[model samples]
Target: MEASKRQETARAPALPWTVRFQIFGLVAAASVAQRLNGTVNRSFFSLVDRHVRASARPDKFGVRSDDVDVDASRGLWARVFKPSEAQSPLPVVVYFHGGGFALLSAASVPYDNMCRRFCRELGAVVLSVNYRLAPEHRYPAAYDDGVDVLGYLEKNRLQDPAVQVDLSACFVAGDSAGGNIAHHVAQRWTAAKSKSIRLAGTILVQPFFGGEERTESERRLEGVAPIVNMRRSDWSWRAFLPEGADRNHRAAHLTSENADLAEGFPPAMVVIGGFDPEKDWQRRYADLLQQKGKAVQVVEFPEAIHGFFLFPKLPDAGNLVKEIKAFMDKSKASASSA
Candidate 1:
């Protein structure tokens, strides 16, 4: 009997490292290690990012892409994508890639592919910003990088004929952390007195925001979602924000106190997942925007979870693209009429 049991145990396949770590609850341990050892974490995260980014499909479908440095001194860069057949100037989408403000880049394969899809579907020139990540670059750094990218686009509008972007119809879009950055950038653009480019709209896909108080969704989905969980979300906040800063910081929480700032924001489309832990906050933000008399629309994926758009094969991904296209079309119509 003992020999039979030993043989059966030996027949079981070994689990992958990631699976093993998750099974043993070492994932959180690694996150703690990341907070303690910056170099090690950066190296590990970079390796994973490289693998993921390498999986991006080649730029086919008549979309042309070029890497451009927005700010040499600050190491700010962007990947610009435009449809090859666009004769007239195309609407500009200043896109930000999401990785909890610490992982991934604009150059990542998933992000690059996403930008290509945006260019193809919306018939718009997409400038995907490669903002610096955190633990190395903390809060307001990414936000500043976003503003600088916009400023660079405004100053160098005609630098590339192949990518002639319509600055007047500029829109901002992002998912997760990128969504949060997009919102902040739009607010800053509205407040800036010397703004040159005009914003037509903002699209936020599953924005990552948190406060000192936990929402029911967060409590229910803690350590539950396949992509993002409460613990991971909390860890990201710690790594991205200034040292010792809490969730109540304005950078994390867009509260009623600062709701007035959103008044000048352009029309916005806030997308949220029904199962996302951050859905409550995202909904609150949309409501706040509406209450402030700002034009806002909310789109909910009732059966989806966070990061659904990242997976192109998912049915929700196609639905999201269609929704965004419709919104942009409506905005364009409004702009033409005005």
Candidate 2:
């Protein structure tokens, strides 16, 4: 029996480099800390944060950035990026960063690079929001922060002299958990019937959403994705959601029953990675939006994985940006005609 087990072990396939590195970091953290505790988790993620920050080589070619506090009481802030050469007021993109609702920051290296790219490529002012994270501030806190940032932008546009923003051309965008927040924020904005700023469109990049029932893609890609897996995603849901709430919560998971919330949503661009476990649900949401008569565009990157936008070197990353630009331009034209 032992000899057979050894033979089976030897025949097992090797994990991908990304998975191996992730496991190695977790193992090293456990070994060095002598225990698996919150402190160790934070320490390990901090190292990852540092690494990501280091890799963020800012491309400020045609863009200039500035930091501003949106609401000090709520500890909300944003890093605003504007195209330097644009003489006229440009559209605004209020962006949120993805970290499973518990990790990453708007000021992180990847997010900074993303904001810079959006500013330069779209010729727009990108307001990358820094909302409070969860496990410290639960569910609705992040959602409320998103709405607050929009309100602040609408009311205080003239205060920032660095960039002239066209409120009529405003849009909200985010990746992963940020995408989830953007969805909720758009709903809130539409519900409020605010005429101060019209949301021309929304871009959801690999939005992180799930439900009590497992998705087919989730089952198929359970342990497959290099960075995100079933276990990690489940942990994030538990950590960020309100206590006693399950994945079925409307805010956490978008279902057909509540699809009405998307009825008045601005034109949307839903970007999904084929290899992502969340792909099924993201696609479903896009279809729901389309069915509701909302103008929606679905862009899929068959070779990409979750959070692929962070890696600008990937071919799909540039294509995703171009898709966003096209969507924005279409929305802009529609808004003008309307």
Candidate 3:
């Protein structure tokens, strides 16, 4: 890790003057928004996302993507990415994007581009789920939408017979708030014992989880880490959790001593950022899974901060892609053997 860190520092390029200036202004605005209510901050953040968002371009990295409907009446839809010349029966990854569960969407520039990279590099199809957001549709809405997407997949097709996908090889994955949704969705899906779709595993990248008690990491990294800080994190929890609910709610707090797992919860790969304020809680979640005798893998990026996976130029981001591919392959083999 030390060598990788040194190499990354040597190779990482500096941001252009214009981009740096834009970042400076954005950060300044955020500093002010932090004092306002979560709703206003959410609106401001959404505007920023709309301005920088990349559209659904299919040809990037030889991966073709299109909008797929799940339940248009409820405004539930997703973006599907399929790599060129993909072999039949390839693994399918259902991905959820991170925005503290209140901001950002599947169409957000970074997430769209990241899914394209996953399709090309991993040689698999990626379904970027656009689950309903919080405050507007709080609590079980996102989680329910997640399970609904699986249900939709079971009944529908990729619409391309040339490139068949293995539903049995299906995997649920997400980053940040999406990661939290991924875990709950997997639990519900597995509990139902859906014979049509087998959840091979889950990939949680810097998953968002919290509790009433602040961990050492949270207190120490409060204002140091970028994007995710103590104040904004708390606001997100309030918005996403049920009304009048506190951080200790079951949805936000999954590390309770008596927390229970679904009977067939799949294997998990937990990514940790050393500099992230939530690392302590992330570690606790992984520990709970391990204590239950679940097959879990913890991948840590020592110098990485929160939301590190969203940046492509970062060495850690590329390394994470490789790690995800390895986990998919290993989990697939294990599932087949079982």
TM-scores, all candidates, are 0.86, 0.86, 0.89
Sort by lDDT, best first: 3, 1, 2
Q: Which regions of candidate 3 are displaced past 4 Å?
A: 1-35, 41-43, 51-60, 256-258
lDDT of 1 by residue, 113-223 (tens): 888899899888888999988878899999999999998888988366555677888999999999999999988887884457888899999998888899877766665
What tens digits encode model 2's per-residue C-alpha lDDT throughout 1-338? 97685344233223456655654564344334322232225565656564232222334385667778888887888888876545678999999898778777877777887788888888888889899987778889999999999888888984545457899999999999999999999989988888889999999999888888888777766656556767666667777787878888887777678756634579889998877888888988888787777888889887677877777756788998899999999999999998
For candidate 3, the C-alpha RMSD (Å) to the true structure equals 4.4
Candidate 3, residue 123: how far the Cα is off, in Å? 1.1
Best by TM-score: 3
Q: List per-candidate RMSD values in Å.
A: 8.2, 6.0, 4.4
Top lDDT prediction, candidate number = 3
Model 3 TM-score (2 dp): 0.89
Better of 1 and 2 by lDDT: 1
Off by over 4 Å in 1: 1-33, 36-40, 51-58
Worst 10-residue lDDT window for candidate 2 reads 31-40
lDDT of each: 0.79, 0.78, 0.83
Clashing pairs in 3: none
What ranges in model 2 sit over 4 Å off?
1-40, 51-60, 158-162
User: Which should have the higher lDDT, number 2 or number 3?
Assistant: 3
| Evaluation by lDDT, superior candidate among 1 and 3 | 3
Task: lDDT for model 3, please.
Answer: 0.83
